[model samples]
Target: MWSDHAPLTIQLTSPLHKPKTMTWRLHENLLSNPQVAQDIQQALTNYFAENLPQDTSPLLTWEAHKCVIRGILISHSSALKKAQEHTIRELTAKIGTLTQAHKRTLDDTLLRELTAAREELARVLRQS
Candidate 1:
């Protein structure tokens, strides 16, 4: 039976959703490229080896070496990415200036050099 006024009811069985996982995927070539991957791995290993204690207990030395190596790897990776960004920015600025030149523009040699720099940047970005 319905009454003149009735209270409302609400129910929720589940909470709002969010992404299950977040990922930053690098290029397949970055991982699949043996040379680059090997180089990175070898560098990390060398870093650990160099920092490891020569005549000390394994446990403490291993832990310390691992921490240092991890820090170095993270810093190195960030540095590489930053360097790439800087190179690209520099290339872009050079190209923009050349393209926006006045009637009395750059000479042939300067124009060619600018073009070459841009092309080199493109090549590096593609490889990365």
Candidate 2:
């Protein structure tokens, strides 16, 4: 029998509500397995260093569906170039990790997505 006078203390928590950044890293960490979060973080940092523009905030807000690369290139201030490069590298590394995991039997849909994403990154870099 359920006690009517019992103190109802309920502690509620849900796993799905974790922040996107944490979740993003979580997926990668799980795939990579046993590596510390800092290792993943460092890998992402290195990837950014190699492929992205010096400034990438503009790219984040830039609409791929509506915006043309040429216009974006012309509009971005020189200061943002580094950020853009960094973003491209980071994004590429993250996507590439997933794409490479399957290797010989790569998922067609995922490959297309990564290819499109890389092209977008290149376009942003190519912008004059």
Candidate 3:
């Protein structure tokens, strides 16, 4: 006699373990911003001035300086990204509103405005 239930097979395997490493690269576009350049210069100047003590090793100071520069770049990059996102959102909303108005009246002025807004939005999206 055979049972109605089918046989089941289960396979078990160990999970793979790998070390996680983080790599950060600077966005070259940020260099074009005058504010970022100024902020980096100020941070380097302060780091050097404060670490001028004779007891500090040059190698350690150099390493620490790298960290300081990284921090500045990261902060500026984050801020820039946030601002770009905000602009993109606003442009999207403006485009939506203008498109609706243009559709309702089919006015030449509204059409022109909507076209301009769409172009602006495209530009902002490309930058981000």
My TM-score estimates for the predictions, one after another, are 0.48, 0.33, 0.80
Models ranked on TM-score: 3, 1, 2
Least lDDT summed over 10 consecutive residues: which range in candidate 2? Answer: 22-31
Candidate 3: where is the Cα deviation over 4 Å? 1-21
On TM-score, the leading prediction is 3
CA lDDT of each prediction against the hidden true structure? 0.69, 0.55, 0.89
Off by over 4 Å in 1: 1-64, 102-107
Q: For residues 55-122, what per-residue lDDT tens digits would candidate 2 score against the true structure?
A: 55546534431233323233333235567778778878866775776475778877887787777867
Please give the RMSD to the true structure for each candidate, in Å.
Answer: 8.4, 20.2, 7.2
Candidate 3: 10-residue stretch with minimal lDDT: 11-20
Local accuracy of candidate 3 as per-residue lDDT tens digits, 2-98: 7998898998665885657989998998889899999999998999999985869999999999999999999998988899899888988998998
lDDT of 3: 0.89
